[model samples]
Target: MGIKRTVLIDEPFPDLFCGLCQGEFWEIDFIPVLVPHFVFLLLLLLEILDDPVQVRCPEDHMFCSSCIGNYLQQSRTCPHCLTDLDPSLFQPSKFVQRQIGRLRVRCPYHEAGCTWQGILSDSHPNEDR
Candidate 1:
């Protein structure tokens, strides 16, 4: 019952990763191979922001919504700056979401022979394979 959404892309921007969990806001599958005369690097699958949120701290640290929420429940402070945290002050990161949506991704079942691939924004959770 977890978020199984996934996508394939080349190296992603470093900032897209959450500062708290050190996770890419999504599950990811990275594949790289080297043959005798060729280098084969398969597209990597990454989970695109599962409810991404941004801290109001001056550093503007970002984290997966669930990760921060759980952390704040125990200690009310920014993970990066230790600034006092107010869960109500957390804001959704539309900019980050848009950026992540721009990434191209293959079906989570690609390795199992599913050939579907497209822009993240255009993908539907209930897509018919």
Candidate 2:
């Protein structure tokens, strides 16, 4: 048997990728040249995303819970203004959260016979969810 070399990745990377959501979907800031026609529309759509929670850093900037969590887990500072962060400052944006919980998105495993289509509050993945 051949020995397998261990590869250590010390950089941050996305934890999951689902082909169902266009795993490499278009990001507003990094739009491709082939998608210029829908640039403005995509930008507007991104600006209108109703993420439920707002994590307020010491700089008073607004961020989604996921964003803040990712940042804090790496360092205890704000990524934008470089201000120190206190996780306790996070607050629930009730209305937006409610709206988000009401929007129905297809399951990431839709191709695998999952007919469970509904709003996702915490985005947890399980066989029955």
Candidate 3:
């Protein structure tokens, strides 16, 4: 293998966000930190499951929620690791949550003619409120 290939593969994605950051993240800012995943849960639900669904395997790999959600419907075992799982085991990804929150998404009621486009947090209302 060429040195160039190794060098190129060593760097992380430029726009990678760790799901908890309220703003953009650079590759250098990556440091595993303890972040609460609750408040971000609602936001996770609203955001499209474009990123990997949070799985509780020994290895922390990402999976698209929709992909895993659908997969879970057919089999309780994780497709990637074949670990037995329950619906509750499939947590929403924190990184994906923050990434989605940063995205300007249409209101959930957009199809109902609500013209709203902004961060997911500001776009949706608290149903309990």
Candidate 4:
């Protein structure tokens, strides 16, 4: 609960994108403004990452747990560096998870007329979405 600020979607934040799907690592509360068409497409593809995991590489690349798990089953190598990977060594990225949890996002039903927007982790299933 620091400064409650909103981020414009015009600038790209590389760390916010998932390595596997190239989609946003978390949904964001978008401001109503005139943005480029591509930005809208990117927003449309936004998804709340499930079980974010960090790869055991120097770069510490991250991917959704399911994505990395499935990829490892096919090839036991880091997707970014092609280095040998040990599935057992993979661990949930608690730091990244916390960061994502702090993000502000509109309700999943925002497009369906829900105006609720707040901290992602604070959103509850019983919300009036």
Candidate 5:
């Protein structure tokens, strides 16, 4: 087997390329142009996002319940913020509490030991009259 030698060619370098105005660009005479137009275009594209998005931690440092649950098994603390969020200690929000009460009703004659089952609206129809 014979070893083959390959020659690499450097692409032709521009000599007379105008930056601001067309002119010859010698090695030492060429100024690096930081085009603001491209950056402005990028900013314009970024601005096209209309809706706000919630931010979350990266995978390795995720602070969400699932991550914390997986990390500590049972102990619930945000991996990033260390905020305590125990599932066993979770309390129903006011909205949820209200909905629960709305969906349930006491006996019509609750004090008289009458135990009936119905929604609050049905149980309190007399109140509407």
Candidate 6:
């Protein structure tokens, strides 16, 4: 067999929040972190298979709960990757918890020279509460 990509789907999506700065996504903005769309799709599939269905933002840049709830009631597919969303497949689980919680990861833009890491929950700080 050829060499395999070992990128873990189980790992949490990187958070963009900064607890130290108490900043939001744009506020703590660094360089652009480019994730190939295909890779993002792969990760989303692995995540949704585990618990309640997840949705993407209108810009197709991030995942959101309320956005998904609203979108699913009208459409059965993700606005971003067009992944089919089956509400029947949604089963709420206490296991449903933020993967990174309040931690940070190398900025997706680390491929360049921007050294920044923050909370993933910071993606859409003004959405829920």
Top model by TM-score, which number? 1
After superposition, candidate 2 runs with Cα above 4 Å error: 1-53, 58-74, 114-116, 121-129
Give the Å error, residue 125, model 3: 25
lDDT of 1: 0.59
Error of 5 at 2 (Å): 82
lDDT tens digits by residue: candidate 5, 1-129 = 000011101111221111112122222212343322211100111111111111132311212222223455754554335565444543223332232223333443444554544543253433332
| Candidate 5 Cα misplacement greater than 4 A, ranges | 1-73, 77-92, 104-115, 120-129
RMSD score of candidate 6 (Å): 13.2
The 10 consecutive residues of candidate 6 with the worst lDDT sum are 1-10
Q: What stretches of model 6 exceed 4 Å from their correct place?
A: 1-25, 29-62, 91-96, 104-129
Score each candidate by Cα lDDT: 0.59, 0.37, 0.41, 0.54, 0.26, 0.34
Q: Model 3: which ten-residue window has the lowest total lDDT?
A: 1-10
Rank list by TM-score = 1, 4, 2, 3, 6, 5
User: How does each model score on TM-score?
Assistant: 0.66, 0.38, 0.37, 0.64, 0.19, 0.33
lDDT (tens digit, per residue) of candidate 2 on 39-58: 11111113222232344764
TM-score of 5: 0.19
Sorted on lDDT, best first, the list reads 1, 4, 3, 2, 6, 5
On TM-score, the stronger of 4 and 6 is 4
lDDT of 3 by residue, 1-129 (tens): 000100011212322222221222221222343433322221212223355466787655445555566556678775656777766776766665565445334443444575655544452442222
Candidate 6, residue 111: Cα displacement in angstroms equals 27
Clashing residue pairs in candidate 6 (N, C-alpha, C atoms within 3 angstroms): 15-119, 15-120, 16-119, 16-120, 17-119
**Number of the candidate with higher TM-score, 3 or 4:** 4
